[model samples]
Target: MTVASKDVGMMTMIENGNEVKRTCCSSNSGCGSSEILVEYAGNEKWIQGVINTPKGVVPVVSTQLNFSDILGSWKARWGVNRMNYKINPGLYAVGTPDNESPVLVTANYKSTFDSLRKELADINTWILVLDTKGINVWCAAGKGTFGTKELLTRISCTKLHEIVTQRTLILPQLGAPGLSAHEASRQTGFQVVYGPVRAKDIKEFIRRDMTATPEMRTVKFTTYDRLVLTPIELVEAIKVSIIAFGILFLLNLIVTIPFGLDDFYAYVGALIIGCVITPVLLPWIPGRAFAWKGWLLGFIWAVVVNLINGWPQLPSYSLVRAIGYLLVLSSISSFYAMNFTGASTYTSSSGVIKEMKIAVPIIIITVSLGMLLILLNSFMGI
Candidate 1:
């Protein structure tokens, strides 16, 4: 049984292309459509309606994303409201699904949920959302928020046994790291089925008796995939750049060190190389370690900076300052490039740790020495 819902509040919000008002109403079976109108008219608007069942009322959601959903996703990509961008972690209905419908599990991250549902435009399925603390499936799985414990607890809380007749729960393949299939099945009486790495393949996966092709299972981190993630990394790098720039500016005011346009250009160039260039050219870069790739590019950029300033030929230029520029630029680029380890699937946790052990000390020593040389050059006329 289902009750159609209408927008009762005067609050203006855009859905699809048209402006519409939204209202908050609990999907509990006790409340009628009329009673819901006057109960509580606040500003929560994600759920469209409800489907009453033997267990409880499951909130119905649209497969199509609205204007607000689109805006929120864009804001999240830029690191704005990133942690807060999530839906309520619970069972939801897409289209008019029955107890026999397949259950697809995913994280509560709004972007992940949006990606899953948008591809299910023609499919009628029940979505089981796990509380991943606004993290995507792959990350949350690594962090353990989307682990076996959370899955068992959510299944019990949602009374999934009563809501659906199926004994299988389809989970994203990336989330496999955290969940032990046998353990979850033992605890919840539901077998786990691993789905495709990408959400777009969900339709085909389901159409083929819940089996995924080899292509569907394969995870590809293409250039476009790496490119989209750069914005957030760049945004974080910019914050650090502001602090570094201020410190350099203060040094110029207090000391005789020549910190000017050349220095600023070199810093920004290194920042870009680390946060954007390294990721975009990841496959083509000569080294296995991201830090090494970034350092090489940053070193080249530092050379360009020196060339622009007419190094060696210029009588006033100090070799100490020139060497310092190379070290600082390369180190800064290496640090930022290492930050991409969390965002990429190319490196394992152990590999990242090993790289850090070898790279971090060198970076610290070189940067410290570089800064000392830059300051020492001012005093000794090196």
Candidate 2:
């Protein structure tokens, strides 16, 4: 069989005792394709047989990262191609592996799968991907999709015990949140092993006799990692255009001149400040809670807006409109910050609940007051 796409090219041949590979050559002798001959188990089933009724077709057991996978990763960052960007939830072989090869388990999220397989390019292993609904391991564990139940279920469904000689299964460290190691061993009879925090360290972990270094045990969210998430947040904020457009329409009706664009710009600016800038600059921003950090940024931006509008005096615009912008814009920023607590690290469920109880009520009150003031100024001809 021959497989070709814009990003990848490959040919496959499965045969008897002799190694099988197709040498790709054009009419000319300019280009030559090297034959990759892997000696696989004759008793083992076809590479495709591992799929069963899995959602995705198994890509001919490869460790090389495809250009298409990198492209898919770019799309996932912007929240595009996120839902279907996943591998089939089942057992798979990285290269030709005997029963003694180590078994590694991971989430079906394509990026995570690619990262793991890419690091183990030279090492032959069994990869058992769980159905995490396309979420990364950490988030999936938090949501319970990467829990002990699904792990045991997949193990049973795939008949893993019958395939591999060893009863040890290595899992990503992030998946520990929802998994009870003892409970899993008690039920499945397979020993659970938590591997390194990052895929890059997996090779080292295995080479050092399945031992993870202290550095590998720690999880760190760097600035770049934090920055990438802002794009998705900004895009998600755009989905609330209905309410924003409604408010803009009302503002257009109230003002005789073209103040609609000004108000709209201010609205969009608030979104940028809240969703994009707030999270990107989270560490530098002052305040323990996300709400206050957002509010501070919003208040500062509101002041800048006021200065642009001639802070001291206004001929046509009322004091209420000026005050209204300050209150409303700051509140919008604060709301975005409060909602973003889930995306940040070291935040507890009970702490988030505690913050929401206090922050939500205050945001509601401030926003309502700002809107009322703007309407009252419009009606009274201020």
**Top lDDT prediction, candidate number:** 1
lDDT of each: 0.80, 0.73
**Which parts of model 1 are misplaced by more than 4 Å?**
1-46, 379-381
Question: Please, what are the lDDT tens digits per residue for candidate 1 over residues 1-382?
Answer: 2112232333235544554322234343422222121221123355667777666667777788889989999899899988878765668888888989999999988899999989988778999888787889998998898989888766765667887898999999999998888888787799898999999999999999989999999989999999989999999999877898888777777666557777777888889899999999999999799888888888898887777778879834688889988898999899899889889987898999999998899899989998888788765667
User: Mind giving the per-residue lDDT tens digits that candidate 2 earns over 78-114?
Assistant: 8897776775466677766656778899997888888
> All candidates: CA RMSD in angstroms?
6.9, 10.5
Candidate 2 weakest ten by summed lDDT: 30-39
TM-score of each: 0.87, 0.81
How badly does each model clash, as a count of residue pairs?
0, 0
User: Which one is best on TM-score?
Assistant: 1
Candidate 2: give the clashing pairs: none
TM-score of 2: 0.81
